[model samples]
Target: MEVSIIIVSYNCKSFVFECIDSIKKLTELITYEVIVVDNNSSDGIEDDVVIRYPDILFFKNDYNGGFGYANNIGLAHAKGKYVFFLNPDTLLLNNVCQTLYDYLELNNNVAALGCRVYDENLNNQMSYGKFPSVIQYLLEVFPVKWVSDNYKNKISSEGYLTEDLDLDVEFISGADLFVRKSVLDHIGGFDENFFLFFEEVDLCMRIKNAGYQIRITSQAKLIHLMGQTMQVSFQKFKWFEESRYVFLRKYYSKKFIVFSKSIFIFRYLFLWLKYLDKEWHKRAVFIYKLK
Candidate 1:
């Protein structure tokens, strides 16, 4: 098989069909299989996949295993030369699958590839970016956002190196990444430790560390309606506080962990203060006060 397209779905019956329909159309140059690993979605995803494409491989988890874990499960059964870790809400642009395979085959050093992505409005969305740093994270908040979003600050407007047009990047979003099975086999699949976010960055970083090229394919475009699988997303405000600590524990030294944790804590404090001051927060506060 040329590729195994793995889609890890969670309560997204709202949109999975369209995504699968697009992939099913790619039956031409890309001799591929579709693996839908559903995370126990109550939205009838299992029956939908079976009823719509019975021949398609679908696995329903008994529980909601995180995104990384579900993709790892799907990859364990993937038989293609290349594998795609695609989200359920993402749609492929014309011939993008074939393009990625051909590019990877020609460039043997490229371990994994990500394509240009657009929002639902079809506006460009950044798919790759510089490795995260403490200073950069701080700059993204409050006083710096105005500056970053204005005058086309190369860092903000550029997102994560999209300007180079077909270049190697430090990390690419797993939302739609293509990977050679050989490279996946060499380094193993996504680090299961990452329950949801940053697994792609972690995977690309590992591949690059192993001397493999992680590419962003500008020619192939994908449409990602971002944050579809996510729920309770104001909670994302806490991902840095929680996951950054998790990341530091895995990849950084003890000293770095201590420093990173402090910054993470401070950021969380700032966010909590802002959250508390919001109208929604005042209503909740009033309810609590009445109680």
Candidate 2:
């Protein structure tokens, strides 16, 4: 197989169908397989998907093992030279699989490649970024508009959100990552400790350390119905924060983690007091519990 497209689905049944349909409609130049690993979703996706698309390989887990763990399961069964880790909430806008596959075939030094991503409205979304740092996190949570805008502009200038040309990058969003299976095997797949966010960032960091390039190309494109797969709630926020800390712990020193946590606690506490918002207060308390 030229590519093994692995999608990890939770409760997003309809989106998964749309995503697979787009892949089937658009991908033609290369041989590929679709592997869907259901993360114990309550929705009856297994029956419907199997009946609708009998050629798809499907597996069901007893419980939701988070994003990385579920994708790791799909990765183990992958039989392609390249593996495409795609989100269920995404739809291809072109022959993205063929474009990325051809790019990798021509550039053997690239460990992973991602394409331009757009929202449902077709506005470009940030699909790649530098490795997370304390300063970047602080800028993200800063309250002042001018400061935040300046930081965003800086990121854009640094090519984190560029869409006009191909560039080497530090991390690619997990929403549409295309990587070689051999590189993944050498790196031991993804770190299962990450339940959701930062898993791909961690993988990219390791890949770069192994002297392979991580890149983004404008040739391929897709639309991501952002945040549709998982509902927004305080519990979801908690999972994000938990994964953030896990990532910090893995890539940073204990002292650095402590300092980062302090900054988080202080920032959230200030926001809670300034806005008198319950959400801010909840986030502050959550960060305190992590200490």
- Highest TM-score: give the candidate number: 2
**lDDT at residue 285 of model 2 (Cα atoms):** 85
Separately for all candidates shown, the number of backbone clashes (residues 3 or more apart, or on different chains) is 1, 0
> lDDT: which candidate is best?
2
The C-alpha stretches of model 2 lying farther than 4 A from their native spots are: 143-162
- Number of residue pairs clashing in candidate 1, backbone atoms closer than 3 angstroms, sequence gap of 3 or more or interchain: 1
Clashing pairs for model 1 are 129-160
What does each candidate score in C-alpha RMSD? Answer: 5.1, 2.0
On the 0 to 100 scale, the lDDT of residue 211 in model 1 is: 95
| Model 2 lDDT, full chain set | 0.88
Off by over 4 Å in 1: 142-164, 232-240, 271-291
Q: Rate the local accuracy (lDDT) of all candidates.
A: 0.75, 0.88
